[model samples]
Target: MTRSTVDKALQDDPFGNQAEVKYKKLGCGFAGLQGIYYNGTICFHRRKVIYGMPPNCTTLVKPRRTKGSRSPSWEELQVKLGNLKELVESARSIISGDMLAVPIVDLSSRIEVAKEVSACSYEARTSWGREIGWVYGSMSEDILTGQRIHAAGWKSAALNTNPPAFLGSAPTGGPTSLTQYKRWATGLFEILMSRNNPILLSICKRLQFRQCLAYLVLDVWPLRAPFELCYSLLGPYRLLANHSFLPKLAPGGTTKGCSGSSHPPPGSSHSSPCYLKTVGLSETVFEVTRKDKSSCDGNGSTDEADKGRFTFDSSPVFIPPAALAILKIVAIAVGAWRVVAGAVEDKRGGPGVGEFVCCSWLVLCFWPFVTGLVGRGSYGIPWSVKLKAGLLVAAFVNFCR
Candidate 1:
C-alpha cells in the first residue's frame, strides 16, 4: 500500500497555502526514519524490503508504553528539534527542490522562547500546534483523510530510512492476534461498504484508473474472511473426513490429481492410496514462540523497545486451539499406533499413510494450543475471556465442520 500523508499541516502551512492549497503535505502517522526516504532514497530500495512492505504512513501513534507520562529537559528538546528542522528541510527538497520555499513545522515543538543562536529560527517563522492536523479518530480515519487529500490533487510518498522515526508493538499471541484481526476486518468491511469507498471515488471520477484499481484491492481485503474460514476449517477436515469435493482427474483421465495420489503405482491403484502432503512443499509452519524472562537485561536504557524486543507471547486465547490440538493429537496417535500394529502383524489392517501423515501435521501445528489449554487455562481464565473463548470456539468448530 502507498505509505500515506499529505504534507506538513499546521497554522504554519510552510509552503504558501493559496486561498486554495496545491501540492501535498505528508503526515505519516508514525514517528519513523527521519529523513530516511527523502528524495532519491525511497526509489532506491524499491526491490526488497521497501516495495512489498506496507506503507509506513501512520505517524500519530508512538511506540511508547502507555503506563505513564514523560517530560524531557528543555536542552534535550532543543537539540532534537534542531535535528528535526534539518530533516524537514530535507523532506521539502524531495518534492519541490531548492527553488520552492517550504517551512517544515515541528509538531512536537514550538520556537517561541529564546534559545541558542545557531539552533533557533526567527520567532515569527515558527509554527505552533499539531503537525498532523488531519482527522485522526479511529481505524479508517487515516485512510479517509489521505483519500480526501489525494482527491484534492495532492500526492504522497513514503520516505525510505533506517532507525525508523517511530515504531510500535504488534499484537502477539493467539488471543491478541485474533482480536486485532477481527477489529481490522470489521473496519475494512465498514470502509468498503461506505459511500466514500474507492469504487465510488472512481465512479465519480475522483481517482484515476490505476489508483482506483490499487484501492479496489484494499477495499476487497475483508472478503478474504470466507475463504480464510474455509481453509482454516476444512484444511484439517480434509484429512479427518478422508474426502474432498474436487475431482480426481481431468476429462481424459490423463491429468494427475492435485495431490499426485489420484492414481497410484500400477497395481497399488486398486487398493492402496497415495499420500497428499508427501508430494507437496509444506512443513509444520505454525509454531508458538514464548518469552519468559523474569528480569531486565541490565541495560541502562529502560526503553519499552528493549522490553518488547525481549518478549513475545504464546497462545493467549483458550478453547479453539486447545480443542483442535487435543483432537489432532488423539487422532494422529491412534492412527499411527494402528499403522504400527498393522506393520507388526500380517493379518492386521490400519489407517493409510496419507491420513496418518496429514493428521500428524495437525498435531504438530496445534501443539501450542494444547499448551494454552493445559497450563494457561489452569490459572483461571477471566469470566470475560471465557465468554469470548466460547464464542471463538463455536466459530472455529462451525468452520471446520
Candidate 2:
C-alpha cells in the first residue's frame, strides 16, 4: 500500500479564520521537516508505541522485580483483565503475538470483548491516560502526548493523498474564531511553561534540536498578543499627547534629543502589566469551537445566510480590538482637526505623517471590528460591546489629556 493508504488519513480543514493559511504552513513544516506529527486527529500510532514502547524495542516489557513484587502470574492476569474467559485468553494470545496466527472461529465473542474494554471504567487506575496511552494534564492533551512520544525517540510521518482522507469544520465567525484562538493559545502556552517545555525536553530527553525549535515557534504564539496590543496603542498615544514615545525619523540622520536613551521604550510599561496579568491568569480550559456548516436546500435558503461575513457577539475577546479601533478613529479625527486649526506648529517635533500612518495601519488591522460597527442584524457589533469599547476609549483619551 502507498503511504497515503497505509498512514492515518489527512485532515482537510475548512478555511474559517484569516490566519488559517498560517496554521497550515506551520503544520506542514512541523511534519515534513521535523518528522513530527502536528494534528492529533490526523495521526496514527502503533499500539505498542501508544503503550510507551520505543520504536527500537522488540521484546515485551518486564515488570519491576522488587523484594516482594514480581510479574503477575497467568491467574492474576485473568483476574486483572476481566472475568470474561474469552477476553483473558485473547489478552494472553495477543501478548504472545499469536492472536493472528490462530484462525478466528467465533467473531461475536471477539466483538463482545471489544465492547467490554471500550467501557468508560476500563482504564480506571491504569496507565491509560497517564504513562501508557494519551498523556493527560493539559487542554491540548493530543499535542502534549505527541510531544512525549517524540521525546521518547520515535519519529512520526505525514501522508498526503489526491483526495483528502478527512474533512473537518472550522470556526466561521469572529466570536468562535477568537474562542478557538484563546483555547489554542492557552494550551500551547501551558506546554511552553510546563516541564515538557521544548527546551527542557531537548536537554533532558531525546527530542531533536530542530524539532524543539519548531515546537517553540508555535508555543510562543499566545505571548505575541500583548506585544501586538501594545504596538497598536503607540500610534494613538503619540498623536494625542505632546510626548511622543517613538523616535522621530529624519532624512539625513536622527533628530536632536531623539537619542534612543531619552525615550523609555514605547509601550514598555503599558504592555508589561497586561502581559503579567495574562500570564498569571492563563488557564487551560477546553472550549468547543462553533462552526458554520450551512447547506443550501432546493429552495436556496440556508441556515447561515451571512456565512462568509464577519459576525460579532458579546465575547470579551472583541473588546480590545474594538477599543483599539475607536482609539484610532478618535486619534485620526483629532490629528486632522489639529492640521485644520494650524495647531501643529512644529513639523519636526509634533505628530506627523509617520504617527498617522501607523495609526491608519492599526485601523486596517481592526477593519473587521470597524465594519462590524455599522453592520446590521447578526453581523453588527453588539451595542453592549460598543458601550464598553466607548468607555475604554474615553478613559484612554482622559489619560492622554
Candidate 3:
C-alpha cells in the first residue's frame, strides 16, 4: 500500500485495534510484505525495531570484522563518548525548548534516544574499561540517571501547573542573586567543557549568561509586586525577548532599542559615562526644539507626534538603584510568602512542595554564611553547609511569626 493509504488506515483504526497492514522498507532490501498487527503495536511482524540497523537482521552482535586500522584507543573512545553525550544533550535541548512546556511523548522519545546513544558509548567502552578500571564506567550512569531524574521531576511539576496562566501571570520582580541560573548553567558548561565541544559550550554560555541575566531582570524582579515598574523599565525596551514587550519592537519604533539593537544598552551608569552625558545634552536640546517648533507651527507639539527618538547608544538607562532596592525587599517578601504558602499547603495535607524553593531562598539569604563554610566539613563544605543554612533559615522564619 502507498504511504497515504497506510497513514489513513492507522488513523481510522481505533487505538489497540488490530489491522491487517502491509509493511515495506521502501529503499532497503526488504520490500512489500503483508502483516496483521495491533494498531498500537511497537513491534512489527513480532520483532522489535532496532534503531540505525537494517530490518530483519537476526544477529544482535555488532560487526566483528576489524579493518586494517586498529580500533580507537581508550582515550579516543572516551572522547567519542563525550561528544555523543553532548550531541544527545543538544538534541534534548532542541526537543524541549525551555523545558517548561514540552509534550510528554516528545520528551520521552528524546530521553529514550539519548539513553540508547549513551548505552552504545558505554558498550564501546567495555574494552577500555578493562585497561582503565571504572574511570569512564560511571560517567554514562551519572549522565543518564541524573538527566532522566531531573527531566521527569520537571515534567511532572509542569503537568501539575497550568502552563498558559502560569506564564501569562505578571512576574513578581524580586531580587535574585543569579546564583541558581549560574549553578545550573555551570553544570552544563562543565559537561560540555569536559567533552571539548565548543559549539555546545557556546550555546550553553549564551543561554546561561545572557538569558539568565535577562530572566533575572524580568521574572526575578517582580515576585512580590505587580510587574508595572519592571514592565515600564524593560517593556518599552526589549530587554527580555521572552517578555510580553516583544511585539512592540516594530521597525521605526522607539522600543526597537532592545530587539533591534545588537547589544542591549548596559543597565549600569558606570559603564557608559559618555553616553549619559550625551543623553543629558540631547534631552535639553529636544525640549528646546519642541518649544520652538510648537511656536512656529502655532499648534502645540502633539504628544502623540512628538514622541522623541531617544538614541539608545546615547542614553544611560540604567536599572534604577531604587528598583534594585525594591527587588531586595521583594525577595524577602517572596521568602515570607513561600513560608506561608508552605504552611498553608502543609495544613491542607496535599502533596508536599519540595524544599527547592525554600532551599533556594536560604541560599539567597545566607550565601555569605554558606560560602564561608564551604571547606570546613568532613561531608564536604558546599552540600553540608547549604543544607544546614537552609534548615536554619527556614526554622528561624517559621518561629518569627
- Which candidate gets the maximum lDDT versus the true structure? 2
TM-score ranking from best candidate downward: 2, 1, 3
Candidate 3 Cα lDDT to native: 0.27
lDDT of 2 by residue, 34-95 (tens): 47454446556775566566666532345344565333345644434445566545544545
RMSD of each: 18.7, 7.1, 27.7
Compared with the true structure, what per-residue lDDT tens digits does model 3 show for residues 74-141?
Answer: 23433423445444334233322324332345565567666865574455633323221122322122
Worst 10-residue lDDT window, candidate 2: 258-267
Give model 3's clash tally.
8
Segments in model 1 whose C-alpha atoms lie over 4 Å from true places: 1-138, 163-165, 171-175, 244-318, 334-368, 376-401
lDDT of each: 0.36, 0.64, 0.27
Best by TM-score: 2
**lDDT of candidate 2 vs native?**
0.64
TM-score of each: 0.43, 0.75, 0.18
